[model samples]
Target: MEKYIDIIKNSYSGYWNYLKNEIFFQNHWDNYFYGLIIISLLVWGLEILFPWRKNQSIFRKDFWLDTFYMFFNFFLLNLIILIALSNTAAEFLNDILSSVGLSLQSLQIFDVDNLPNWLGLFVFFIVSDFVQWNTHRLLHRVPFLWNFHKVHHSVKEMGFAAHLRYHWMEPVVYKSLLYLPIAIIGNYDAKDVAIVYFFTITIGHLNHANLGWDYGLFKYIVNNPKMHIWHHAKALPKHVRFGVNYGLTLSIWDYIFKTNYIPHNGKDIELGFSGDETFPKDFIKQELYPILSKNKDFD
Candidate 1:
């Protein structure tokens, strides 16, 4: 709360400085935000050229709403991440690290710094994305939590923008969980962050993609659109206990959890929760839907 006030004060008090440093390239996430745009363009292009649901148009239903999500999440919600997570994580993790008589600087016994750049990058991506996968599963499984997560699943027409589609509160829930552990590991650096974003953001678009370019064996390693589309299935298939295929980048987590589902005709799967034809279409209305729900139960 104080942090939000501080950001507002900073922006209003020093408008130009805030616009230049806080809101643009100088900010920590600016590069990644721009990268998201480029990646969206690429995925949008691919979906147009070699689409899975070929009859679907580029400006499909809810297209602008999803695009609004893409930009809103990329800019404002992400800025919240930088402001809210950074200082909070630094303070929280420092206390815990001090209790254990270890520090991010002194965790060098792990030699994370000296590792080959590529390996360090891999470690960062794997650990961070695993955190995301776990959080995603919780959003579906936990009834109370699903209120905030339902905006993401309400999508019936999946595409590149669908990747960025999520409740605005998601970063707070997911990134805060992400921040503490990474701060403890203390292995994160600019290079590692960049590498992780490069793969995760780009592939994230593909996972929500309307394309049929599923890599055969590689689908088992990295999640693809085919299996992921089922995650949005209107109803669970028989024998499926809960929402399945809860992977952010790698499919191995679902395999390990025994939750991976890939039906033979998964590509043709219609999405969104069953009996949910009343989900709102406008962005503001959808944002407020969860708040106004009379029967918000997930289970």
Candidate 2:
């Protein structure tokens, strides 16, 4: 009787230990995918409920192009980061940026070191979103960067997949520059960085989605598909319509900088520069040889 009671107590303790650490702590990726599935489904449902444009379906060519880059990043680029630059680079970056006021070090009032990891992550997300919003704007305004960025705007339509059809060089350059600031100031580890990566991906898909649902409260914090569609507007002249909606997560920067564009008509605006004489059809040409022909020669 006494022996049986002891066994029961021991079993309960073991179960509780597993529940606390293994079940709760170890479910990071599982929870990640689960949340992603839910968000993806919500976006899909919104697409069906209030699609801004139904005529523009996924482009077969663009679909494959996006898939190729997605797989390449998942299989190859990540492997390189994990192997080569994941460790020392993050530390070196953090140290250099620590001296400047660019980074928020330790959650302390002056240099608060007591902030929990969760709070730190939340702060990093906001800061990085601001950085990306402004950096993207800079690209649009700057002439040389526009050459690379125009490849993204070259698309004439919007969809979940359209968000992925970016110039490959833009990612390499933009991400490296963005990460450099975060790595220096944010004290982010590989795991935090991974969170930012997927967060950006999920946010980006939502950005290009045709969903019409609007969360009045969230509009200030996050940019919706409606706002983003205008960013891809092709006919609105250079630096006017497409220049706004630069926020990936927050709309504060866009609002503050006068880059926010609110659509007046309930219609899918004509996108892509039709004036070009010869548009590249294949991914290889757009991604690889954007400069082969002179810009003026195109149209």
lDDT of 1 by residue, 110-184 (tens): 544567877866766777878989998888777767777778989889898998888877777787788655654
lDDT of 1 at 297: 49
**Top-TM-score candidate index:** 1
Looking at candidate 1, what is the lDDT of residue 151? 89
Give the distance in Å from residue 129's predicted Cα in candidate 1 to where it truly belongs. Answer: 1.6
TM-score of every candidate relative to the true structure = 0.85, 0.69
Cα displacement (Å) at residue 258, model 1: 1.3
Give lDDT tens digits, candidate 2, residues 218-243.
87767777677777776564547336
Model 2 segments beyond 4 Å from truth? 1-50, 58-61, 73-114, 192-195, 237-242, 274-277, 295-299
Q: Identify the leading candidate in terms of lDDT.
A: 1
- Off by more than 4 A, model 1: 1-30, 80-82, 92-111, 238-241
